[model samples]
Target chain A: MDLQTSKAPSPKLPHTALDRVVPHSESDWNDAAAPAAERHALIKSEAAGVQLNLGELWHYRELLYFLTLRDIKVRYKQTLMGVAWVIIQPLLTVLIFTLVFNRFVRLETGSLPYPLFALSGLLLWLFFANAVTNSTHSLVSNANLITKVYFPRMFIPAASVGAGLVDLSVAFLLLVALCFYYGVALTLQILLLPIFVLMMALLALGVGLFAAAVTVKYRDLRHALPFIIQLWMFASPVIYPTSVVPQKWKWLVTINPVAGIIEGFRAAITGQHFDWIHIFISLVITLAVLASAIYVFRRFEDTFADVV
Target chain B: MNTAIKINQVSKRYRIGGLHPGYMTFREMLGGLVTAPFRKLKSGNGSQTLWALSDINLEIGQGELVGIIGHNGAGKSTLLKILSRVTKPTTGEVELFGRIGSLLEVGTGFHPDLTGRENIFLSGAILGMRRKEIERKFDEIVAFSELEKFIETSVKWYSSGMYVRLAFSVAAHLEPEILMMDEVLAVGDAAFQHKCLDKMNAIRQQGRTILFVSHDMAAITRLCRRVVLLENGVVSFDGEAREVVKRYLSSSLKTGALKEWTNQHDAPGDQVARLRRVRVRTSDGVTTAVVDIRQPFGIEIAYDVLAEGHALVPVVEFYNEEGTELFSTHDTSSNWRRQPRPPGTYTSTVQIPGNLLAEGSLVGHVSIMSHFPATVLHAQERNAVAFQVVDGPAGDSARGDYIGPMPGVIRPLLQWTTETNELSPKSNVQSPTSAGNS
Candidate 1:
């Protein structure tokens, strides 16, 4: 090691003598000092508390838009069905539910036609399910970008959630057409559909933030994520009405945020009484999950580049 | 002058091969929960960690183009990552005064299914350009890439050269206040590389700060006024670019100038010949790790000639600092050219003339060939020995009165003649008259 270190300085034989003559001019030292005091950004190993840099996120909102656009474009490109798959996916699922639950199980949907009831539920459920699944894999899928550039890591999972909105809107159109075909009367309550959809998106994004962060550390989630989403669908009242739950267990079913949104979607479009208690519970739960998810996501954010 | 970037006591620690899985399954998490107490009792720290970077401190003034050079795994990329905020440092802090654009990789966020035009926008946005900014520079980026014809074609269908050209063009057109690059220019052909360098030079002239990391010594020397040499996760030296590069090359070559094969069976060779040792030495036959530009040097290759009646030609190829082959020479002795060598160990020496090589490191690739039958290579060793050629007193050498780095691979002292002939009075007087008549 000593010999190696000794050899290092000798290679610059021509400049060694000259370098001693002029170590560094005062102008050069002053130049380096002048700009350092006015630095706009300071990155430290540990940030202060759990505060997320919302300002930075706001500055990079355009990147969020572009990333979301890329996901939507890439998802449809080269597919035979293209944008039609977004509609077909839920319609087919709704058909299966109407056949299996309405026809075979003879499930009651509180006077609403089974197809109308199932399509509305399926639209929101599919968006939530797809958002959760896609956002879980978002960070790992964009590992190339994560390792190469710096942006708010939140954008990856957020983009996944945003991209799913495009699909949700397309599927919602089909649901509206199905309601008209079934002669379902639209009411003032139906104006609240966007709020329910927003809640569902927030719920998905909340869970997705946690899952995406975890997926960076443990990749087994990548495979198990779809299975989790499938199980979560059964847990939520996507196919059946919450009224079908045993009177004693109704409280348990309403704890699922999706149940309230899906149930609210049915009541909204079919002119049923709005369930404020259940909607309020779902909003509280969604906000709680989203808050904690952001906390955990930011906590693990620094390690994503290393772990991924 | 303002400071563009400042790093203070930064360090990065990475977990080495350990059971700490980065991606875990539900089963593993459940299992970990079940055995949490036992695991904690058995091992204090779950995994072994290696510090990739340790206590790095650096400051760059506004408009300064600094180069960071190091051997692989010396934490050059880790430092860049910390600077670019791709990953947080384990300790200390970094500050930047201006909008930073990092090209750790060309086309980093490019989707293969997206067309060239779409990718230009996508990549530009990923690198922190606004949509309007991309729209404004879109045509210039396309022209720079020379990919007008393929702009509508998906990048998946693009040849790799086209992909790199378009990616680099987008990155080159990014007019950030501070730019960080990591070996992205190593892609593409030589001409494209020069174009990129020229673009970087223009960027520097605009008074923007730049941080460049590359293994290409020539590029670093040409583009960077200052260089920081990282060794084993720490800054070993930081000074003038030429001086730092020279230190880096020599330190890297400390063990590279000599290689000995203690075990014959494990040596690099075929059945016909095997290498014993290779060394670079001064004219006095004393082995030296570096050579003086004004002094002659010798490359000594010792090998065993295992078979009889086989003529062997020892060839030495000299490559400049950029890894471009300057020239190749073979020992064409009258004895070896006419006759076959008896089976024995033979030492081949090739002398490099003084003042022939430029003042930089020259890497010699040693190979022995059987030229008589089919010109088959019996044994070859790449980078067998590397020796630095430092500039001696310039008066007697070709670099007379020049204080800057020389340009080419070879700088030779050759004779020159100049003559001045005064025109005859008769011809001089007739020239004006003839021109006026015409």
Candidate 2:
């Protein structure tokens, strides 16, 4: 049905009658607004040479601290066991490994007791495992903040690893007590334990950052990561000493970054001879993986906000 | 004048119906990797690209309070995201001077497990505030939120209002050189909204550049002297706040004084009835988008009843420029008000007298509902038709001789009575005791 009107047939509605209708202003497209000599942030589609700017990271250090603090607070507040769980998990794992390793395999553990031997390796392994696990899901879990706010995206995975450090410190107390109970004497080699721990941390962070970035795009990593970690445990010297492996397969142990770090860490705690070759191999692999992981992470960082 | 933000040829392209659907599973990625050669043979199929923004150029001067107004999908949020560096544009560059803060949402990064006190610090840091800055403004933020008693309690237990209050308070205390807020004030109580408005006004006085995106024309006109209207990822109008807002509101309602659906199947309705048309017309039966304040106008709703034995009530609601619903009316004078409407077409009209609505853009939403047996709303259309109420300054109508801002939802010319009683000496000089007794 047509709209009956006294005037001509019209399909479009007439403009509303108002006093002093404002005309469209001139589109003052200013292409020549000279940039002043002031500090400014320029956001472009392609970031200029994704630099691992230490200074920028230092500026956001407080955010990194707060995010880590938030993770620790929230993680502890939700559970009844709280920090005690950190000690209990590693302690029970050490007990089970000690019992099984002693009964199943007859290998010389030198002078150090099997329990202390397993605990030393287990402590560093557990820290590395937890840090990797935590950091892998960090980007996906904090997708809210990543999409809404602007900060160093790496800080998310970094904070997850940092939170694990707190737990490692607490569980370190359990290792010290085990040493005291076993009447183990203090030695100069214990000073190198921190270096091994640093190597373990570097390896964990490298793997974690890589996993976190990839997990943002492929969430199946979340399901597959646990299985990978479990297999990686057997590959490392968490349960048995690396000497038992055949010479032909020992090269595999050398290339396994965490295997060397774990053996070196146990040696430092037990006052055994340091494996300089293995430690050097671990350092090389750790730095390489860390550098490559950071490169891969920074490459995927720009698209995170859009896809996450 | 120094430039605060210069958006140069910025554009954002998003892939639609892509192979991965935004994110992929590892299984799918591996499968895609295996079938990459096969998929290359069948390329140019599913994925479509959308340029959310297209070479939009804008230069905002420092200390300018600009309001960005647009409809949904008009790329206002995308622009803000690009400027705030939440996401990078597909092409183009945005330059910003000084420290910038963008609040696309309040309480962003707030964990429910954390206490209100912890969230204040966490959220503040997320918004780019320093720890020392948060500590310095801690008490002020708490006071602004009016949530001092529950500051230590976990946010999970706080009411939504309290959460919003806490979130907005922290955001308000941020002292960035440039602040971009997207509809943050659309929450909280009126009093709290006013407090936020006051805080924003104070921020403006500090010569800090602010970019506000909101659909609330009232707030836009109140706070921003300059406004930008975006339509389909392009700047359509950029000028004075009042002029830009008027164009924005009117342009949104420009489908005119008459809306019709000839196809019964495509009309908005259920099985009971379908709305065919909604029209705003003068008493002379001529459709119009503008009406003189001194003349009565009628909003006519025509609908087709598909099912019989249903008492249908045609309703019309009027809203002003500020989005306040002035009033609603139904066909209470209908002959079939108590009877069932037959399966046929019907028309209902509600006449609104002149000088009853304030002089501004008036939008009407029409609906058809049934109240008998069970309440079933068949159709409801929002902003169906809009008309401007023109109240000329001729010393007539409700304004009389007043020539200033008339702030009210309605401007009805109601009757009044007055009596002038001359204050004689007898009553004016009455004693306090006598006045109390009287």
Tens-digit lDDT track of model 1 for B1-438 = 788898999988887764664555677789999998897788666256778899999999999999999999999999999988898988889989887778898788899999999899889988877787689668878977889999999999999889988888888766667888899778777655655665666567668799999987756765677899999999999998767876787677654667789988888788888888899887788776666667899999999888887788888999976889999999898877947878788899999898898876778899988877778898998888887776633357776633434578798878754332333647745232332343
lDDT measured at residue B191 in model 2 versus the true structure, 0 to 100: 53
User: Model 1: clashing residue pairs?
Assistant: A35-B2, A35-B3, A36-B3, A217-B22, A217-B23, A218-B22, A218-B23, A218-B24, A219-B23
Candidate 2 per-residue lDDT, tens place, A180-282, comes to 9999976899998889888888898999999999999888899999999999998888878887788988888989989989988888877888889888988
Chain B structural similarity (TM-score) per candidate: 0.68, 0.64
Instruction: Assess candidate 1 and give its TM-score to the true structure.
Output: 0.78
Residue A79 error, candidate 1, Å? 1.1
Off by over 4 Å in 1: A1-39, A47-49, B31-47, B254-361, B364-385, B388-438
Lowest summed lDDT over 10 consecutive residues: which window, candidate 1 chain A? Answer: A15-24
Looking at candidate 2 chain B, the ten consecutive residues that score lowest on lDDT are B429-438
Once model 2 is optimally superposed onto the true structure by TM-score, how far is the C-alpha of residue A276 displaced, in angstroms? 1.3
